[model samples]
Target: MSLAPSSAPARMPGWLLILPALLFLVAFFVLPLIDNSLRSFEVGGEFSLGRYIQLLTDTFYLGVIVETVVLSTAVTVICALIGYPVAYYLVRHAGRWSGLIVFLLIAPLLTSIIMRTYGWQVLFARRGLVNTLLVQDLGILERPLQLLNTPGIAIAALVHVLVPFMVLSIATVLQGIDQRLEEGAQMLGASRWRTFLEVTLPLSADGIGTGAILVFMIANGSFVTLVLLGGGFQTLPLFIYQQFTTTRDFGMASTMSTILLVIAMTCLYLQLRLVRRAGV
Candidate 1:
């Protein structure tokens, strides 16, 4: 005998709610990626990775790749260092001031990235505030220092810009941690540092992992920061931009972009594995 169908239609509305987002992703994200991947392989309708192969063979492109990796690694480490203390403070100490502190963390993020980078350009210029302070006010330097358009400046700006995301991510983790766990550790005579290392740190691993992956992805594709701050040097994103706009080499540009995407995905995958092993 056939069983009578029982209606459980509630799940259908939930799926309907997400359908718009699914359509948007398909239209904007998935389709574009597939199209770009196809474009990277073709030159006049013939399939080839000659453009990508050229990128590896070219010393300049290789250097761009190395620089991109180094910059991202440095930014991620700096963010963690700055973020951990802030995260700890917000979670444990800030109490009545937590809301304001969270707002402060988000303040710079609300500012436009291009505008922030431009602000750095002005601040770091030879005749800018930095040199004015050092040379005129402090009488420390004989000439204006070369702060603008350098790797150091780029990394500094990057850290400044991205630190909030790290803080937020870490704070999200900290918020979820049971206060009882830390109180228990303290009651058992564990030091604050010991409690953090043994309990808080482990519990917050997932948020840290998410933040690191997110920041690294942004750092790797950094075009404005690298361009304005690196002083015309090329990371992969900048190279791809130049190829597309300056040289009008769509094939090569698409290839470079594809390589960047692959690298980003690979790094994210490794981070996922690490976070899993870390038991986050």
Candidate 2:
């Protein structure tokens, strides 16, 4: 006797599976952004571009924009310079210690940002370890130097915080590269430097691009680190904070937020293009 064919369970639609996530984003992310964008244009309950005009035209505001871009660029460059070597070592030679290297790289990220920033403050304070070491131990300075709340210190702190991102990005790309390729290059009489310059570097460009985009986007929106360590440096975030809290100009604050969002979106677009070009 032949048995009746068993019925199969119906499969759910892919969109249905993600409907909750979509609704959550709409409620939390999309709605807030739309509200902010609308507020930027609203002046006394009417649409106006006065806020944008002022932000774009005023030299002080313009300077803050330029300074924000410049600071992000500097941080990106410095992170790249510091991260590449550590990534190279991690990927090429870490061996059994790779886990330890990765742990160290990620440990700082697990700490609270406020705590990390305060740690920097302590190290750079007037009677801090750095001042003590330079003046008393090393005799490098006649007295404690003013190290805290400066642009250089801010940049250094940012680099210290962001370099791990760069290293991890580059390390991920490096792991995908074939060892045979490097060995072949060496066998063809290429020196280690030449092999790296021509082969490894070119292949790892996508990682550098990805890391640069990440670092730049983050540095653009950085508030706490800059606020504590920047010595009154004016960037868009700080300016936006001042506009909201001090000047009580919500419209201007919203406009600055919109501008910062645009900048971040542009960097994200570049990152996507880079990923696509790399076939990743």
Candidate 3:
């Protein structure tokens, strides 16, 4: 026999509160994704495998996808390399100076991304401020560096944009760590270096992995940074934009976007696996 209505556990309003969010997600994200996916499989507005076949056979599209993934990976690695120490210092060393350091970490993130990209534009351009400083003031070089329009500069700019995300993800994990653990390690004849390697790094692996995934995803999906710095290097984002807007082929763009979605989902899955294994 079914239980009476009143015998059922009273449900919390947390779900009720989230109903609007759920609705919005369905309306926006779910619908758009479904439509895009449908479009990716279509030819002339009907179901077909032509789009997928075309994408697979197209060498240019493949190159664009590879370039985007590689650039994003580079950005993620750079952000992790630089962001870890900054996060570590904020979590471990800074006490009264924590507020100041945190602000310094957050200031760039707070600025508009467009503004940041423009800053890079000015810095990296031939005869720009960086070139002038390097050649005239620092005497590091006799000529202005051609830094404005290369894959390396694009990656560098993207890294600058992405580093803070890595730092924030790492900072959260660092904050959660017990300070006494390090003290205990010190008492047990472990030097600071050994303690960090043995205790801190292992424990902070989840955060590092999370940050890497976040940065990598952002870098992979980037359009503005690549367009401005790449100067027509043709990443997936720029390619999609051109496909839809210039070439006026929404189908190809959607196919490319689907490929990107696949890549993002794979990265996310791997990140979750890593985090789970690390016991995060």
Candidate 4:
């Protein structure tokens, strides 16, 4: 007698199943990107690289791009440093307060960005709580220092806004790790620090990369925080905003936008490569 076949039936092609989503992306994302890129090259009713050439030759624009990158990188590093410890604590030591801690960490995300930026504005004002303590109570300065619209304040606000993302990303990864591995390492003559360095750190590398990418991308594209907290500092996002709104220069705006897009994509690609190579 012949045996019955036991294989599963053939499934629909993966591409066919995802065709709707692919079409949506092509229509909304790819088409817009192509249009903007083409717009960036158009000038005087003809195809030209005038916008890009102008951006390259303009010292002010170049400086804004540099500042934006520096600020974004700083925010990413700060978020990682602060978030790693918080995530580790939540995963390993929160105990009874884990729920409360997680709630507090995520609560800010529910608030509007405009509201958050305004809150920072009030706190960083000349006579705000910070200056009151520094000047009146502590005598750190003779008078209120200018904190609003400053680079430091911008970084601080961005950190506050982005740290939760870092925390969540890292905590998700940490939760998936087997506690026994850490216990095993420590039981086998390894110190806590050694176990973390050798096992936990490597294991959580992917989370770190993910968090950094999210923070960096958000910070790089930020306009609200810089506007309310950066105190007249110009970044690439602000430049793009002004080009379109103030100057009515769509070509220039499109050029800066494309450049920003390229930078963000490059960083994302590099981070993924690094994460993959680390086996994370």
Candidate 5:
């Protein structure tokens, strides 16, 4: 053998390897957040809590906050309730109809949100299919009911858009669960419902928590859907937009943005804690 020393490739440190991503995060996300936080606190070249104080003290802003919370919670709950059964069916019966179901679930996401919302606009019109069916075909109503621009319609649109996320999340977790655990529970004289309650539900907590946090975060930040569906009913994001664009109040906009960020982070933290406590 030649007397050449064996050459080994040097391994990079983990931190060095991740430096680009860390730098990107700092440049884009972290720096923007810091800037916004500082801007929110800035008032007339001096630091103040006046923007936040106004947000908390004003009834209009408070109402928007409450509305945002309620809408987000309602959408999350509805998605969870509806998505579980669909996810379970997909996991348990993977061969038949699963592909079609998945296709339908993902099809809407591929389209533009504006186009989808406009489709809803068409359906919700006075002479739309819903009204046509109810009034002419079904004869359930003598006159077309005002269906558009209502809180109910807004919630429904949000649920339709977001439910797929919840379904996929839960289904992914459920697919990894061993079938023996569920069957064993059933064999122990437990009814199907009881077995599911005791065995299947507990293991799916992680997925549920993940989906809930995601849906809640997205719902709170909803702009286009709420504007198109709510029909003048304003939420926090709308409020922030108005502050920034219409009122040109940068301080208030930044403050509201920061508050929204806090709310999202707090909700995520609490959900993680709950999921951990549930042993998921």
Candidate 6:
């Protein structure tokens, strides 16, 4: 007996598949951004560039912008330097212990930021473990140093919090790299260090770029960490907070936000271009 031909189910269009997400983004993300951008340009119900002009001309705001860029750059560099070696080890040598190492790296991220920042406060307190070790056990100092509420400590905390992102980014890229490439380099009489510098390192540039972008963008917007540990160090985020809370100037705040967004987007574009070029 011949069976009737079965009909295939209708397939959904690609755009229809993503319609929900697109609608959600338009409602929440895009609309809010547009509103904020509009608010930034408005002056007494009329549109103007006064806010932008004022921010660009003002020395204090310019200084904050510079400081924010510098702080983020420093954090990104430190994360890259610290993460690359760990990532290399994790990819090439961790073997059976890789899961444990990854857990250790990600564990801190699972904790609340407030809790982590407070933990840093506890460690840097007058009689905290760090001070105790330096003053009592090691006798490195006569008195406990004022380690809390300092720029250096803030940077260290940022690095500690962000290094895992860098490590994971690099590790992912490293996993895709062929071991035989390195083997061939060494087989060609290249020293291990030379092979790493010439071959492995070049191959991992995309990861470094990705990690650097992540770290830089995050450090740019870090608020609580800087507020608790930065000792009055000003950045765009801090200034934005002040504009909202202290002065209640929504226009100025939105203007600064737009500027910060532009800076971040510029960096992202540049990094993506570099990664693409490297891939080529």
Which predicted model would earn the best lDDT?
Answer: 2
User: Per-residue lDDT tens digits of candidate 2, residues 174-265?
Assistant: 99999899999999999999999999999898899999999999889988888778766889998887887789888888888999999988
TM-score of 3: 0.85
lDDT of 3 by residue, 62-179 (tens): 7887778877777888899999999998887898999998788789888887898899888878988989999999999989988888777777778888898999999999999898
The runs of at least 3 residues in candidate 1 whose Cα sits more than 4 Å from the true structure, single-residue gaps closed, are: 1-24, 231-233, 266-280
Q: Where does the lowest 10-residue lDDT sum fall in candidate 3?
A: 1-10
The Cα RMSD in angstroms, rounded to one decimal, for candidate 4 relative to the true structure is 4.8
The candidate that achieves the highest TM-score relative to the unseen native structure: 2
| lDDT for each residue of candidate 1 in 111-220, tens digit (9 for 90 to 100) | 98899988998898999999999999999999999988777788889998888889998888788889999999999999999998998898888888888888898888
Candidate 3: stretches off by over 4 Å: 1-17, 267-280
In angstroms, the error of model 3 at 89 is 0.7
Task: Please report the TM-score between candidate 1 and the true structure.
Answer: 0.84
Per-model CA lDDT versus the true structure: 0.84, 0.89, 0.84, 0.87, 0.86, 0.89
Clashing residue pairs, backbone N/CA/C < 3 A, model 2: none
Window of ten residues with lowest summed lDDT in model 6 = 1-10
Q: Candidate 1's error at 139, in angstroms?
A: 1.2
Q: Report residue 177 deviation for candidate 6 (angstroms).
A: 1.7
Which runs of model 4 end up more than 4 angstroms from their true locations?
1-25, 138-140, 267-280
Which rank order by TM-score, best down to worst? 2, 6, 5, 3, 4, 1
Q: For candidate 3, what is the lDDT?
A: 0.84
Q: What is the lDDT of candidate 5?
A: 0.86
Error of 5 at 242 (Å): 1.8
List model 5 lDDT by residue over 40-155, tens digit each: 99999999998888889999888888888988999999999999999999889867889999998899889887887888889988999999999999999999989889878878
Residue lDDT tens for model 4, 1-280: 1121233234443346578999999999999999999988888889998777778888887888888888888999999999999999999999999999999998999999999988987787999989999999999999999988787888888999999999998998899899899999999999989999999998898889888998899889989877667666678898888777788877778888999999988888977886687565
As for lDDT, the candidate ahead, 1 or 6, is 6
User: How many residue pairs clash per model?
Assistant: 0, 0, 0, 2, 0, 0
lDDT of 1 at 198: 98
